[model samples]
Target: MNQLLNLRAQVVKTLLSVQQGQSLSTILHQQLDQIAPKDRALFHELVLGTLRQWFSLKALTLPLLSKPLDNPTVESCLYVGLYQILCTRIAPHAAISETVTATKQLGFPALSGVVNAILRRATRETEQFQQTLNQTHGLPSWLYKRLKKDWPEQLESLCQALKQSAAITLRVNQRKIGRDAYLTKLEDTDVQAQACPYADAGVFLKQSVQIPELVGFSQGWFSVQDQHAQLSASLLPNLDGKTVIDACAAPGGKTAHLLEKFKPSLLIALDQDEKRLNRVTENLQRLDLNSDHVQIMAADATTWQATRMVDCIVLDAPCSAIGVLRRHPDIRLLRQASDIAETVALQKQILQNMWQQLKVGGTLLYITCSILKAENEQQMIEFFAEHPEAQEEKIIADWGIPQTHGRQLLPLDQQGDGFYYCRIKKIA
Candidate 1:
């Protein structure tokens, strides 16, 4: 019992630190792998569930706090505690006891009484107190305001989708095995999956599985990618021998997919972060994609000089990542309204600089994992105004909402992450 309390306290402490400006993903990466395998899933569940429902919990607990807690960590613990009792399958009595016992583990032994009192009171008046709670659309006020102001029509549905967890989707390497053959393998392994209609290689899993444990994971028969993201590689023009660059490619999903589908004479996987670039290399090696045919560069595409312009460039430009809030809960907490403007500026810089690297009349696929208009449709509109030589090519896909110059895939349950893609042809 005490052991469980200790683990719960540690998880709460890490989450609290993450709430107070630390990266949840970074902290989880360092800690989750070290935890006992049996506890890892629950640990992830508690952390993710707490963050997923944080807004509702905050509203429920506001009136319970008579005075401000001395430490933010303790305050965060109460949030997760509420989540355990109200959301998880954990028994209420055990949750209350463990949470109260955890005050000492959080280095605040004196706050045991405070934690117990608040949690017990919350438990007794749970339904009534929650009814009075105000919602922040499960987002920071500033961001909620922006999303509402920009997309009033879709704000409700969009926020709802942002609160849900994403499903695991895979893209098969048809070069190694046919989709039907892969499905047969999955059936033999007792794993259920369905073919995704949007992308030829995409597969939707009925249940999530670990990456390394997947049947053909190491064999390079398939790769993990969102069904929506699979569209980026699918939407591209034929690259039978043309040069292609996955600008901002890290972890190399699209790069590998492009290689698996098309015979790009030369593919350049470029990223600004060398640490992240190594991940791209590792992914390529694991997928058994031709490392020799691809040039992995650690230089920023915005400034890197190319010997010659490439025939095609897939600029997965960095943005606010607002569309993928559910996948990365920390994004909702860490990203601010001001960050969008900064990202927009950086995106503009990357787009303009990389446009110089595309051969005349070549295809430049501009993409972002952002739902905001400023970062998607509006950005493309602004880009067109500046570069008359750049002509918007129709994204000839049945998926995603067609925008003035691009296709916007607002995240839905199965549609995958909210992504924007605009195919541009350099007419000049």
Candidate 2:
């Protein structure tokens, strides 16, 4: 009983940390080691599950409280308890008992009765609670309003997509193994997977497995990348032996993909965070794609200068990351409406700086993992006016909706996260 109470308390603490603006990933990485190995999975599930339906759960529980709880930890405890009761197959009695015990364990013994009463009331009103949740859209008001204004026709479907969990997709490293051959190996092990429709090298796994335990993980058969992200490399023109730069290239999935697809004379994988650049190096070494031709550097994209004009530049600029909320649900909590302006400013700075490095007639593929027009189509319109030398290169693709300046891929359940892409060429 003490062990169960400790585990539940840990989950409440984690959720409170996230509520206070810490990223779920960073907290988990730092604290997972402290949890008992047997309890880590439950702790993860409770935290992630609660976050995924945070707004919905909040709506369901708030009505039960006479007034809002002053203590954030107690509120988080209620959310964690409510999530398991509604979402998981766990029995309501067990969920209520464990949560009530955990409230006392968290040094709130006086409030244990409050926690027990609220959870019991919730269980008794399960049908009514679900109805309330169904009416709630599960997104903060600002985001909901923004998305509604941006995608009026598709808003309902878009909300549904963001509410669900994302699937595991992999991009095969063709330099090491063929897609079909890798599928066969997975099938031989009774691991179900299928080829992705859009990307020639993409595969979708039926179930999540420990990545390193996969058939060719150690041999670098593939890298986990979304089907949408895999589309970026093919969007650019041929670069058999041209100079290229992947700006903001830490955790270098696209960088490695570019190296595999085209033998660029020089490929500079550059990012501002020197510590994150280690991930780029590790991925390159794992895929055996590291070579003298590929140079990884730590430098701000907005200020970094190329010694020579480059044939191509892939600027995967940072943005609000709204498109990936389903995969990173904490984003719904961490991101704010006011953050968009700041993100747009930084994107403009980097775009202009990277443009200077492109030779006349060289291509610059601008990309963002954002669905907002302010960060994508609108940003491009302003850039075009600022730089007359920039020419729009229409991406003629069957996927994604064609925007005035780029293509917008909406998030889809069990498929790809939302992403945007535009190609531009410099003209003298």
Candidate 3:
């Protein structure tokens, strides 16, 4: 019983940390080690599931409270209890008991009764609670309004997609193994997966599994990448023996992909966050892609100058990350309306900087895990006006919606997260 309470207490603490402005990923990375391996799954499910449906859970629980709870931790406890009872297959009695006990374990023994009463009331009024949740979109008002304005026709479906969990997608390393061969290996192991329809090397796992435990993980047979993200390598013109730049390329999924597909004469991966650069190096090395041909550097994309003009540049610029909310639900809580303008300014500066480093007729693929117009289509429109030498190289692809500037893949249930891609050429 104590162990269960400790585990539930940890979930509440993690959620409170997110509510306190810490990222869910960062917190999980820092704290997962302390949790028992068997309990980590439940911990992650509780934390992520609660955040995914945070707004709706809030709506379901708030009306039960006569007055708002003064303590944020206690409030987070209520959310955890409400989520499990309403969302999971866990029995209502067990969910409520564990949660109330966990609240006491969190040093709120006096409020344990309050937590129990609220959850029991919620279970008793399941239909009404579900109605409240159904009516809610699980997004903040500002974001909800923005999405509604941006995608009026698809708003309902888009919100529903965002609330669900994302599937684990992988990009098979063609250099080491063929996609069909890898699928055969997965089948041999009873791992259920299917080839992505559009991405030649993409595969969607039927369920999430520890990445390192996958069949070819240690041998570098594959790299976990989104089907949408895999398109970046294909979007660019062939770069065999050509120079390339992957700007803002920490945790180098795209960088490695570029190297794997094109075998570029030189590929420089640049990112400003020095700490994150380590991840890029680790991933490259694990994939056995670390070579003299690839250079990983910690540098600001907006200010760094390339030694020479390159044949291709992939600016995976930073943005609100609004499109990947399913993978990182905490984004909805961390991002603000004001942050969008700041991000746009940064993206514009980096685009202009990268443009200066591209050779004439060189291809620069602009990508972002964002669906906002201001950061995507509108941004491209402004860029076209600023650089007369720049020309739009329309991406003729079957996936994603063709926008005024590029293509957009809206988040869909059991499909890719929202991503936007635009290809431009230095026509001067």
lDDT of each: 0.83, 0.89, 0.89
Per-model TM against the reference: 0.95, 0.97, 0.97
Q: What is the lDDT for 121 in model 3?
A: 88
**CA displacement after TM-score superposition, residue 105 of candidate 3 (Å):** 1.9
Clashes of each: 0, 0, 0
Tens-place lDDT digits, model 3, residues 1-428: 33545777888888788878999767687678778888888888998999999988877777778998989888888888888988888899989988988898889999998999889988998888877887788899899998998899899998888999988999998888999999999999889999998889999999768888999998889998888888898888889899999999988899889878887889999998898899888888888874689888999899999889899999999999998999898887899999999999999999999999999989999999998989999999999998899899988877889988999999876778788999998999
Residue 355 displacement (Å), model 2:
0.3
Whole-model lDDT for model 2 versus the true structure? 0.89
Tens-place lDDT digits, model 1, residues 208-227:
78878879988888888888
- What is the total number of backbone clashes in candidate 3? 0
Task: Give per-residue CA lDDT, model 2, range 77-185, as digits (tens).
Answer: 8888888877788899989988887888888888888888888887898888767776788998899998998899888888777878888899999999999999999
Which candidate would rank higher by lDDT, 1 or 2? 2
Q: Give lDDT for model 3.
A: 0.89
* Per-residue lDDT of 150 in model 1: 73
Candidate 2, position 221, lDDT: 84
Candidate 2 clashes between residue pairs 3 or more apart in a chain or in different chains: none
